[model samples]
Target: MERPQNMSIAPRIAVGVIILFHAVGLVGLSLPATRPLFLQVVPWHLLLMLLTIVFGHYKLSGRFKAFILVVFWLGFFAEWIGVHKGWLFGNYAYGTTLGVKMFDIPLMIGVNWFLLVYSAGVTMQRSGLKNGFVRVVTGAGLLVLLDVLIEPVAIKFNYWQWIAGSIPLKNYACWFLVGAVMLYVFELFNFKKQGIAAPALLITEFVFFGALNLVIGLWPL
Candidate 1:
């Protein structure tokens, strides 16, 4: 199924605005003192949720919708458990970026997980790959690959501080595992349809976050 003929612009603008803010955040974090403020607002994953919603509105199959939501929630739970146990993503505690928390897990953090996994799952679905196993494995791998760049920058800005010298491989491996499971679950849920609206939504997020970073650089707040 292709995208609906009557898509609205509001979602597009919402995504654009979110990206704009993130770009500003990136720049803001460049300043020594104001950096924390910028880091606080850049929940890079929220845009992913917006993207998922957009995909849904565009008429993604019910199975894909459930798949996106479930995979993300799985990651969300995993992150919460792993962070508390010092088994996943390291023992770094979250800062105000996610607001106040319980068990060292912020509610917004779970929201972020949902968005990230949802977007990733949709992306993998559209990659034209034939083997379900290969798609699931590769999709998870892609997420971990993206995380390799995201983790260091996040740590440097004090979004979260790792007690260890560096984030461990186990942390990334866990992410891959969760990602794979999510993808498998999505497939199991039955997402054979061809329309998910991920391309535009993800592109929007990339632009939003990237631009937010740029604006933050310019304004330093």
Candidate 2:
């Protein structure tokens, strides 16, 4: 079934704003003088990204809406457990960089998860993979790949800290497990394609984190 022609000026504006915001962030974080200030506003950047996705995909069906809620709470609960019990994603603790926290879990963490999973799911759907299992695996793999780029930069920005100065293998394992389940739910809903927003958001985040990782890895300043 064809997706409804619900496209409008709003998503375009949102994408433009996101591009401009990231452009500034890339330039600002590259400079030592502005890096600290940029990092302090990371939470707001995250919020804007979330809003951009919401605005872009505003015409969601009922099932898609329910999927979003379920994925969000799943992500939130996983992080909550991971922080307090060190069970899900290994021994990791949130830092002040991601802004406010509830029970030591950053609220933006759940938002970030939903954003990535949704984007990745939509991206896989566009891949023309007819097999649901293949789509699920590939989508989850994409999420893990993004996490690879994010982890180092996240630690450098003090978004979270890992024990023993290294990310544990368990973290990635749990990410795949949770990501696969989330993608499965996404596939179950069989949502109509929204537009380029999902792919754009995914690629933007990938580039943003990947560039930051490369810069920080090389300079280590």
Candidate 3:
């Protein structure tokens, strides 16, 4: 018997398994006591970078690749500066959200945000967005939209430990500004075109974490 070339069991099964795990995690998060804590430690942000690499969205034209690398490093440094100097995110300080510290900030947290913004740049490119006004605006908007989902979860889970209660609108505005400008730079370098494989990456993330969050009960365990 000849199998269809288009038919492959591996990806289907892999994606299914990822979805299942995430779902279970989500379910565990529903408990009132567990919900806050559960949301904090989970590595959902890293999933974005994982998506980029697994789907081969990391490769780009040499010049563009270099540009993205610069942006990545810059994002990391910016986060470190923000956390330590208290210029942007405020004086709440980090605990579970940051995990461990390096240079008075969470090393892993810096890495996560860097990769997250990079992934956003990659996804925007894949969305057929380009280096124009509309594309740039649209791409930035999507990043903000994703944040909309992340913020409540972060606060609920005590990720940033907002001291004054609730996330400030200014904080969100800064997110949009940073993301939009970074993406704009990527577009300028034409790295945005390297996003053809973004759909697969996004699907992988959605299946994995979406399911995980679902199973985890969208709260803590």
Among these predictions, the greatest lDDT belongs to: 2
lDDT of each: 0.61, 0.84, 0.55
Best by TM-score: 2
TM-score of each: 0.72, 0.92, 0.66
Q: Model 1: which ten-residue window has the lowest total lDDT? A: 1-10
| Residue lDDT tens for model 3, 62-132 | 67457646665666666666667757655555556546666656556645554555556666666654346
Predicted candidate 1, C-alpha RMSD? 4.6
Models ranked on TM-score: 2, 1, 3
- Candidate 2 on 43-147: residue-level lDDT in tens? 898888877777677475577668778888889999998989988989988999988898888888888888889899888888888899999998898888889
Better candidate number, 1 or 3, judged by lDDT: 1
| Superposed model 1: Cα runs more than 4 Å off | 1-22, 31-36, 43-57, 60-69, 192-197, 200-221
lDDT of each residue in 15-108, candidate 1, tens digit only? 5554555555545666677865555565544554555455445444565456556655676677677767766666767665656566676666
The deviation in Å at residue 190 for candidate 1 is 2.8
lDDT of 2: 0.84
TM-score of 3: 0.66
